[model samples]
Each structure stands twice: as structure tokens, then as C-alpha cells.
Target chain A: MKNFYKIVAVVGLTMTLVPSLLFYFDVIEIGQMKLYMAVGTVLWFSGAIPWLGQKRTQN
Target chain B: MADKSSILKRLDSLYEFDREPVTRNKLQGIGNFLGMYAGEHVAGTEFVIGMLFVAHGVSVRDMFIGGLIGNILAIGSWAFLTAPIAVKVRLSLYWQLKKICGSMLVFIYNIVNALMFCFLAGAMVAVAATAVGIPFGIEMPALSDMLPNSVGWVVTVLGVGTVITAMAILGFDALARFAKVAAPWMFLIFVTAAIAVLPKLGVTPGAGNFWEVARESIWTGVAREGQSQFSFWHVVFFTWLANAAMHLGMSDLTILRYAKKWQYGFSSAVGMFLGHYVAWIASGILYAAANSDAPGVVAYEAIGIAGAICVVIAGWTTANPTLYRAGMALQVASGWSRWKVTLLAGAITTTAAMFPALVMKLLDFVALYGLVLIPMGAVILADFYFIPKLGLQSFYAEKKKIDFNLAAGATWFIMLALALFLNLYFKIELFFLPAPIWILSLGAYLLFSKMYQKNLKLNLT
Candidate 1:
């Protein structure tokens, strides 16, 4: 269960970071930065919920 | 099994055993310290600090050199002062205080400590929300605005606060794991963001002349309109003392107690240079460009959505651990479940985040907060190192089973009064008070402890 949560967190954060990475590499236009941000937000919240929820249960 | 039983029985015999044991092996290695410090320091305050530098009117030369010197001092304080005591005692600051100052005094001090931490974390949540709100067309609090200023801002802050608060409530393993995962990516993002924007700020790529352009145009060290000028001294002092409460004030004693060696203290250099130096400079450059481009508008508008989002996440990462610590302190004080206290603390911090004044006056707030908490660190130092040499017993309250140890209590009050008097009557800067207050508290604790012990003996005699 712990490993599962960790995996979820890692995937979520990575997805969130993908747009920023693309921006850094000049593959994404400046105008599209918002798209990346929106996607990142979704991934971040999704990743956080499971990990945090499981933690609460364990405690 | 026999040894375990004997140890358990022994612990049951001594009231001290009911409290957690201060085992030496629980101390962490240097890498853990480095990751934790770096992740924390780099994230939240970078946005505010960068803006403040622009506001203060620091010069290019001053910003670079001052930041270098200041961070050195900060790192040194952690390595020399905080880590030594932490490793030696292997006890949380709360547990140590319970012995030295008695339960009643520790309770009061912990409440105040936790509240200050919550407010500070609240400000970080506010910082993060500013970015998160950008995409939703949400309004953010302005520099001069104090109240929520917008319903959107309030909702965003609450949303960010809830996530951060939940992470904090999960305890040490989660905190460490999240920091480790987030820190590396955050560091990369900061570097990449700085690089990505350099050209937009009109610095030529890879040109030998770019350094000159960067110096003159990008981080020109001049204050924006309506902002106070900060020089080399201001930058240096701000950086050095920014975490003064954590290092010199010994708040990290709780964290550092888990370090394997004093050398792990030096690992704070990762945070200092990476977060304080690199991240701060990058964010400052970003903000400067934003301000110049937008003119009379808020700096966030100029940086656009990406910059705003970065600031918000940075703030959240920093706030999460800090609020967690605050919750721990409160839990220790009130004897409430840690999760419950942390959740309550999160709510309080979220509410505090609604007020923008704390975020706007972050520099002043940090300085004042450090001043308030520093005396207790000094007291602990004096009680641990000096009292025994002076023929006074350490943990006098536990020895005598007193509810309130007057000596520790008096020392704390006296030091605070003196600090307040200096700030109010003398009109001294809050930054300068910690040194004098630290010295005074140390002397006061030593003197009071000796006198108190002697008087007690006389009563017995």
C-alpha cells in the first residue's frame, strides 16, 4: 500500500512537471503555458489525494 | 526479549520513560538533511524575497556578494550551534523544555511558537495560491491589500492549504518522502525557469557580453517604484537572518535531533545556496522583468501564468513542513492527537492566509517572529551547557516535580520584555535584537537557575 501510494505520487508529480519541462526545452510555446499548468494542477491534486488519504487512515 | 523486557520495566519505573526516548541511532544522515533543507528553503519565500529585493533597491554587486556572505552565516549557525545540541541531546525541543522549564511553561511557549509558525505557513499558502489562481482568472491579493480582497483568492488559498495541511498531518515519513520527490524537480524548475526567461529579459545567449547585460539589465539591483531600496547589507542580513529562528533560534532542534552527526548540520548549505542563492536570484530576475514589462500593474501580471504558478507551488512546499512542525509543537503542548492539532493548525493558518499584510510585510514578520522564539533556544542552551557547570542541576522541574519552574519562566519573560523595550523605546531594528536577547537570556537563565537551586537548598537546609 505504501509503495502504491508512492508510485501514484511520483506519476502525478511527473505528469505535472511535463509541461514545465517542455517549456524549458522550448518545445512548448509561451501561450500554451496555461495548458501545461492546468494539466499539472490536475495531476498534482490527483496524486496528493490518494497519498494524503491513505496517510490519514494509517495515522 | 529479556533485554527488551528489562528496558520496558525500567522505563515504567521512571516518569521520564513515559515520554519518548532520545535514541542516538534515530539521527539521520547528511543526505536527508540536505534534501529537506533544500526543498524547504527554495520553494515558498523565493517569490516574496525576489520581489522584496526589487523593492529594497539592492545593487547588483550588493545582491550577489551580500547573499553569499549571509547564506554562509546561516549555514554556519546551523552547523555549529543547532546541530551540536541536537546530536548531543537527541531529544525534541518540546521534550527537552518539558524537563528544563516544567510542563506549564513549555505549554505556554509551545502554543505561541505553534501560532507564529502557523501564521508564517499561512502566508506561504497565500503565496502559492497567487499562482494557482492565475489560470482560473482568479484574483490575487495585492501588495497593499490586507484582507482576502477577492473571493477567488480566498478559495484558492483554502484549496492549497488543505493539500499542504494533509501532507503535514501524515507525519515524518510522508514529509521526508514528499520533500525528496519534490525537491529535485523543484530545483530543476527554478533553474530552467531562470534560463528560459533570460533571453526575454534581453540577455544574449552564451555571449560573453551576456554577463554584463545580466548585471546591468536583468538583476540591476534597483528598486521598483514605491519600493524601499535594499543594499548589499540588507540582502546579506536578510538572507543570513531569514531562517534565524530555525537555526540560531534552535527551532530545528526538533528536526536535527534525528541527525546522525553534527556535520549533517553543514548540509544546510544545499538549501542555502540552491534555494537562497540560485532560486532567489532567478525569481528576482523574473520579477524584475515582470515589473518592467507591466509598469504600473502588479508584478505577477508581467511574469504571466507560469511564474505565478511557480511561486504558488514554492510557497506550498515550504509551508507544508513548517505548519507540520507547528502542529507538532501544539500537539506536545495540549496533549491532543497530532493529526487533530495539525488539522486545527491548518485551519488557523488558512484563515491567517486571508490577510495579506503578513505576506506583504514578510521580511518584518520573519524578523519579529525569530526574535520572539529565539530566547527559548538561548534558555535551552544555557540550561543544558552552563547550569551543570555552575553546580545547578539540569531539568530542575523534573527533579523537583514542579508544575512551573519560575527560573525558566522568569528568564523567558525578562528577555521578551527587554527585546520589546528595545524595539519600542529605542526604535531598534528587529534584526539586531536576537543577539542581545540571546546573550541576556543565557546569562539570566544561568543566574536564575543557580539562585533558585540555592534557595531551594536553603529551605531544605
Candidate 2:
């Protein structure tokens, strides 16, 4: 489960970073880059649900 | 079948601890602050603001210097004026106002506050529509337009508004979560899109004449055909006072109250620098790079479909929280369920969004919105500080169990009246109104409070 969380976090984070990185470095044009990144962003947050679901209360 | 009551019941089950102070255990780290501010600030409005700067004939040097200075003051205000109060009080601005102004005065204040927030969010929704309508080839609203441009525009606004409103109805945590994730990607898109367009403005990668390109092509010191010129001070005030209501008006008492420490107020710097400063500059470059009036089309020209989509989401991130705030304010004032009031608030916001005039006249609307709300913030400040000092009482209404605090109500009305008189008769511009109104609110509050308390011989501490 712990490893699953880490993998999900890493993959989700990379999805977000890669498109921006590709665009930033002039490797990719702006076309569809925002769409790609937006999907990645949603996945990034959604990936956390499993961890948050079982997380204990702060108190 | 699931009905309205069932829906309201499920929504109520979320049960955000609204009226109570947030416990230490529930305190959020700096990530939430950083993400939320960056998301909210680095938003869809930057597209319009940056384009307007070009239209208003702002020079590069003046815009850069003034924007930087103005943003710094805004950060200071969030950190110094708003954050400290928020952490100490640990209450939403609405709830805290009820304590000081009592129920009646607070009710009036909440209505004004909610409408201003809804209108402001509506402008963002309209901004999103500019992007959504790009594919359908709906004509974008011009800078001077005051009415809905087409049925296409109306349909796009409703579609966009429904999605954002649904997100807002989920409550504050949902809003924050959405922003936290969306902010990073949205911000990066803003920067990359600007860079992608530089080549079009004759500033190719090897040209190495970026400054010259920026000066001549981007922030050209010549206004569009019919627009008036903006100066350094204009840039500074507009940039600083842009969120003057959120910061100086103490609306962020609702946001910052969630912070673990007052120093987290400094976190506003992320949003100011990234969103207002860099994003504005980038969008300006895009506006100059492309001839289109629509942010979607301009971004589409530079970066592609994704760039246009960024404009849509940028509007979403900003509008979501703003509508959330409006919903909360109306819910408290009307004693209705949060989700239902949010629906009503969203309806009003969507209606406002149908008219492109809301987006076209954004500069004036923002200035006026902040102006109307500034006096109440001043009154809040006075009550927070002066009541305890002048041998009067803090939370006088709460302590005395009164339904109406005439002093607080009187201060709001009289100060607003003075402001209207100044603007209408004296012909003061919105840019010049906040400072004088602040002074006026302070003085009027002190005078009224002294007179009200003494004449009534109200319960003194």
C-alpha cells in the first residue's frame, strides 16, 4: 500500500511536470499541452484519495 | 428518489465548522496557502488585465515598476493588516462582523458583500466563455461592449457557470483542493504560452533583443484608438488595489483564518509575484503577439488548443473560490443552508456572466467593488482596535445582546455616501477613492461610536 502511494504520487507528479517541461524546453509546442497538463493535474490530486481515505485525523 | 431535502441533508453532513474557531489540529500547512493564493491570483483575469494595460498605453518601465511596487503593498497588507487579525480572531469576516455590528447591520453588510463577490466571480465566468466559444466561432465581446454579444455567448456562460457552481457547492475544502492541484499547471501554462508567442513579435530565440521587443511591441506607450492612457501611478494603484478588497477590506479573514500562523500571510507573495506580476507580463506579451481580443484565440494562436483551455481553467480556479465566499456570506446572512444559498448565489453569478460587459468593464467593476467594500473593512478595523482602547467595549453587540449596533451601521452608510458624493460630484476616479474613503471610514466610525455609546449610555466595559 505504501509503495502504491509512492508510485501513484510519482507518476501523477511526473504527468504534471512533463508537459510543462516539454513546453518550457521548446520540445513541444503549446497545442494540446494545456489539455495534457490539465489531465495530469487531475490525476495528480485524484491519486491522493487512497492515501487520504485511510489517513487518521490530525487530533 | 433523491430530492432537494436529501440533497441538502447530504450537503449539510459535510458540516464545515463555520461559526467556531478552527482548532489547532485542523490547521493547514503552507502548501494550502501557497497553492490557493497562486491559483486564485494567477488566474483568467490576468489575460484581460494584461491586454488592458496594452490598450491603455502603459509603458514597459512604468508597468513593470508600478506593478512590482503595487504587488508588494498587497502582500504587506495581507501579511500585516489581514493575517494577524484573522489568526487572532479565527473567524470568518461575516461571523466576526455579526459580533461587532450585531445581526441587523451585519445582514446589510453581507448582502452587499455577497453581490460584489458574485459579480466579481461572474466576470471570471464570462472570461471562461470567451475561451469556450472559440471553437464555435462565437464573436468575442469587444473592450467597450456592455451587453451579451450573442446567444452563443449566453450558452457558453451557462455551461461554464454550472460546472464552477457545482464545484463550489461542494464546500471550502473542495475549493481549496481544486486550487492546490490546478495552480501549478495553470501557472506554468501562463509562462510557457508567453514564451511561445515571442517569436511572432519578432523576438526569436537568437534575436537576444527581448528588452527592445518588450518595449516597442509589448507595453507600447500608445493607447488603443479610443482608450485613455495609463501612467505609472495608475499601474501601481490598479495593481495594488486590484485585490484591495480581499486584503484591505479584510475578506481574507475567511481564507487566512485557516492558517497555522500569522506569518503565513507572507505566503500571499507567491500569488502576487507569480500571478499578478509574471502572469500579467506574460499575458501582455501574448496580447501584443496576437491581434485577437479573445484570450482564448490569442492563446490559441500562440500555444494551441491547450493554451486556450488554460484560459478556461484559469477563470475556473479564480471564480470557484470567489463564488464559494459569496455563498458562505449569503448563507450566514439569510440563515439558509449553505448549499442552497450557494445555488442561488451561483444563479446570480451565472446571470451576470451572460453579459460580456461584466468582463469588458472589469477594471471599473473591480475598482467599484473594492471601493464599496473598503469602508466596512475600515469599520471592522476600528472595531477590532478602537473599541477596546477607548474604554468602550469590544464585540459590544455580542456583549450587550443587541440586535442592531447603530454606530457600525451608521458608519457604513455615511462613509459610502461620502464616497458616492466624491465620485459623482467631485469627479474623483475610482483609483483615487480608496485612500480618502479609508480615512473617512475611520473618522466616521470613531465619531459615531462615541456619540452612539454616550447618548445611549450603552453597557460600558
* Candidate number of the best TM-score: 2
lDDT of 1 by residue, A1-59 (tens): 75676666666566445654565556777556545554554555456556553332111
Candidate 1 per-residue lDDT over residues B272-307, each given as its tens digit? 999889977876676666632111123244324444
DockQ of 2: 0.22
- Residue B343 CA displacement from its true place in model 2, Å: 3.5
Restricted to chain B, the TM-score per model reads: 0.85, 0.90
Cα-based lDDT for every prediction: 0.71, 0.78
What are the runs in model 1 whose C-alpha is more than 4 Å off?
A: A1-59, B1-21, B158-176, B209-222, B291-309, B328-343
Backbone clashes in model 2, listed as residue pairs? A30-B303
lDDT of 2 by residue, B1-461 (tens): 24434433332333344778877876789997986687678887888888888878899887899999989988998998899999998888767877887766765676687899899899999888888888888888877678887788888899999988988887556555555555665776677778666666787655688889888988888888777778888888888889888888898998898899899999999989998899889888888988677777887776666677778877887788778868866665455777888898999999999887787667778888888888878887888887768877778778877767888888878877888898899988788788678768877888888888787674453
Worst 10 residues of 2 chain B by lDDT: B7-16
> Candidate 2, which segments miss by more than 4 Å at Cα?
A1-59, B1-18, B22-28, B166-176, B258-260, B332-340, B458-461
Docking tier of model 1: it is incorrect
